[model samples]
Target: MSDLPLRSQLAVALGRTASRMSRLAGRGDGSVIGGKIGLKLDPELLTRLSADRKLVLVSATNGKTTTTRLIASAMSGLGEVATNAFGANMPTGHVSALAAAPGARYGVLECDEKYVPLVLRETGANVVLLMNLSRDQMDRAGEIWQLAGKWRKALEGVDTHVVANCDDPLVTWGASTAKRVTWVAVGQHWREDSWCCPECGGPLDREASHWACRQCPFARPKPDWILHGDRVTAPGGRTYDLDLQLPGRANRSNGAMSLAVVSLFGIAPEQALPLLGRVASVAGRYTTVQHEGRDIRLLLAKNPAGWLEAFDVLEPAPGPVALSINAQGPDGRDTSWLWDVDYRVLKGRPVWATGERRLDLAARLEAAEVDFRVVDDIEQAVMAVPPGKLDVIANYTAFQTIRTRYGRAL
Candidate 1:
């Protein structure tokens, strides 16, 4: 039982009641509102809820939600593990999850990068997962290096054992000063943010697998866990061939990092492999939805790095694809990063663009000489495609909107 003050316990009860009310009213997912109310009544809701639990905190610029789902699913074999499976990574989300699952002795949280330190401090998490960091939500996130600096300071003197990606310079620098670290050589495909040293603004030298600053001491740490092709080599020479429903090299990388964490908990990679592989979609990502006679698959990519991975999976599809772009609050106000993606790859493919900023995407596709048409309604644009398995991609808010509409139909 929690040793929290009586006042704090009352606050938690009040917050859970609010969550129920929100859900009943059809306002939205009750997680956010519940968290807000809990924290309002008792600012220490995170600390109280996280008490006496084996906390595993996961944070990164991309893939945190999917990685968290993979980790949580793998942990399910252990027992009832509390997690915010809906992709809410803030303090309130953590509070809501813990409050809902009071019986859970184990907690796995996907934390936002900006709030990682606060969550770490509050929960006193034993293990932290560090994935590669890249440019995301440029207006709110500012520069990527600044976020890395925040991570670096947060890890300093912290007692948690860090599982970090050694292949990415930003991640390396952030996890460098941690009390203890387990480096994993999960490859990084995005290098634009790490072109120069985060420690010292010097030119970085790159080799076949790792990178290092030419003039400074900051260099990539050799990974204790390494991914070679489809196989992952863990400590003590144990190897497991990654078999995941989630496609692409990125998910494989995420699985490798998760395996490294699982090993630390006395669970073998072989035993956890099947559990992680069963996670086909985190929330609505990569979920198949039948809408208006067209079988549409939902794909979400928030940034350039994410877009690169999504394109790799979408390229082989035999039908025309639809893309929705929006600059809403959840999707970030800035959409200039659209220019950085290699849209030329879609040169010969027929593209249907629709969203608040479809014109922006149209401009990019037109400049690349890609054959495309813009439709105002997303559902109609998707349905207008030749009847078959339709491929659809959208930014965060735009994706959520379509997922809500057709997800109900399913």
Candidate 2:
């Protein structure tokens, strides 16, 4: 394990060892792997990642991985950029990503929200992009709004040039009022989160699809950074046009956000747009695979918000599904929080639960009055998992497990 070729490999080995250690010790995580390793590694990284190369840290409750990869891709169109496509977002994860890069010009790392302050301070990023805030992993992560507030205050004190999402009222208020702020927003989506005022907590009255609060009478003013279009036209919290072939409004936002970061580095949109199409898929994010004559869409679903949006995007209908559940690693070991998600969203879909934590998830389905078959192992479960048209979503830890299992089936 110590002789691993890459940091991703090291992280994977450590993660597996930690999971087993946790099981033996009856602890959720093995002996503080992240913090312990982080402390031991913090000093060495500064000399390792020198001032010659730029480091841009991307942090968010969600969309960090997507934004990080897109930003890296957009940056590479201009020049050399090294990044960890793997989903390691914590301080340890960020360290591993940077260490793994042999001689990359820029370091683009998707950082975990809780570890953002420390990594940001250490990395001394030239640009820091803050995506929207939403409820995720209540068991491990506390209040969403509270964490957002704390992040806003901490980032404001930092000297890094801040780029933030403005569609979210919470982020908009924080960024719009901050120093060196370039706020970005999108046009109205079919499902929007800002209709209600996060301030006085009033319903927003749509003026022209742009939106302003009716109860509080606070209308949304455009951000300082108008990269391509207005908020609604921008779509998924980024400046989006029609040319990008990425699926879903979320990917569009990711493209726009990526372009914005690259634009800051003087990369022209026209030059970068064509190059973006050439970048390959960053695995485990809507990564598709065919298994045993069945089409499987593997999505990494984490919190309630992410799952709900994925449920909307998947629109599973009457198709078969394999919902893999695992509480190990970054997947949030506590299964009690499953109740918060709307599993009923799986209604009318042929969904079956799998993975080590399948029984735990099955219990939630029973409680929710949603019937689902409990197939303990993902491999065995895939036997019955629809072979033609199917949707499979595995959150955090389960995704890696399922990919390896179902990949064998394919």
Candidate 3:
């Protein structure tokens, strides 16, 4: 930045001051406003900051934060790496992150799907990780396929190498035109959104593990990397067992993709596995907090797919689980996605629904024939757990609320 003009440097200085003021004011994480001010002053702030860094961009509907953390952890072996660990994934967040870690040699950024093109173009990232695409925040994000189409258009003729999930047809179509791609079969369970070919608008012929378009040339490419359960097989038949603290098959897939992305940086899975395992919690997800004198493990469930994964993690635990839902800005205004989830799995278990949308969740539980009680207060919900450890799952806002109530920094 010393080579930059005086006005650009002043913009950066002002942005940093704004970031400090935002933290002092307790407004939020301060990433958005800081980057906003910087970009407002110098519109090309991201491009300027990321000029000489080796960048790896991670984008997905789910597991992006975890995957970004995993990649950032592994990249530490290479050099100083910059990332937005707080889940601010838009342009503002990217600008703020680059400014915060100005000396970092490498940047592993978790990019929002809509802003991936701009970030990629500006940063000139060498590797891009394309994770699964799903229906998330529909009112704000629009359709999943529409975003994928933008990705395809944005990536055209770019020289960056892509590591994409071959199991997802949407991802496959998005990365099809990349100059260089390393396909990874990371195992996707959500196929509801990718039932047809993005190329020809035809039905895809599906199998147990792979799919192909019946009417078009586009299909699941041959994967150079594969994940079998918790073990990931590299290109050379070398396998690394991912014994992650983060539970569930979804995390296993995230680990696989993270391994694939880092491998492009010449960091093998054997060296990256231990680093990835150390991530116990990401922004309060999959963590236990002592709040109101009960041991409450926090799980975040925002949509049907996320709820399904959260239920799988909660299934093996004890009784009287707590669930909180909210229809806030980040969680999306639509709660209709609840009906799409298979809540019958909790039929015999006792559940306590709590949050801004607690009644909506209670009504959904009733319709699903599940036994549940409604308690809107977190303290009461924690006390409602019978003698054992309390397990809690909440949507976006509710999870952050509980985390803040417990005095954890956002």
Top model by lDDT, which number? Answer: 1
lDDT of 1 at 202: 97
**Residue 144 displacement (Å), model 1:** 1.2
Task: Write the residue-wise lDDT of candidate 2 on 30-93 in tens digits.
Answer: 3245333533634444334434568777876667887787788778854667565666566655
lDDT of 3 by residue, 38-109 (tens): 999999888898888898899998888889998999889987898998888988898888888878889989
Q: How big is the positional error of residue 207 in model 1, measured in Å on the Cα after superposition?
A: 1.1
Cα lDDT tens digits, model 1, 240-331, are: 89999988888999999999887788888888899988998888888888766788888889899998888877847346788899999888
Candidate 2 local Cα displacement, residue 400, angstroms: 1.2
Top candidate on TM-score is 1
Backbone clashes (count) for model 1: 0
Q: Each candidate: what lDDT?
A: 0.87, 0.64, 0.86
Error of 1 at 313 (Å): 0.9
Q: Looking at candidate 1, what is the lDDT of residue 227?
A: 95
> In model 2, what is the error at residue 152, expressed in angstroms?
1.9
Error of 1 at 280 (Å): 1.2
Whole-model lDDT, candidate 1? 0.87
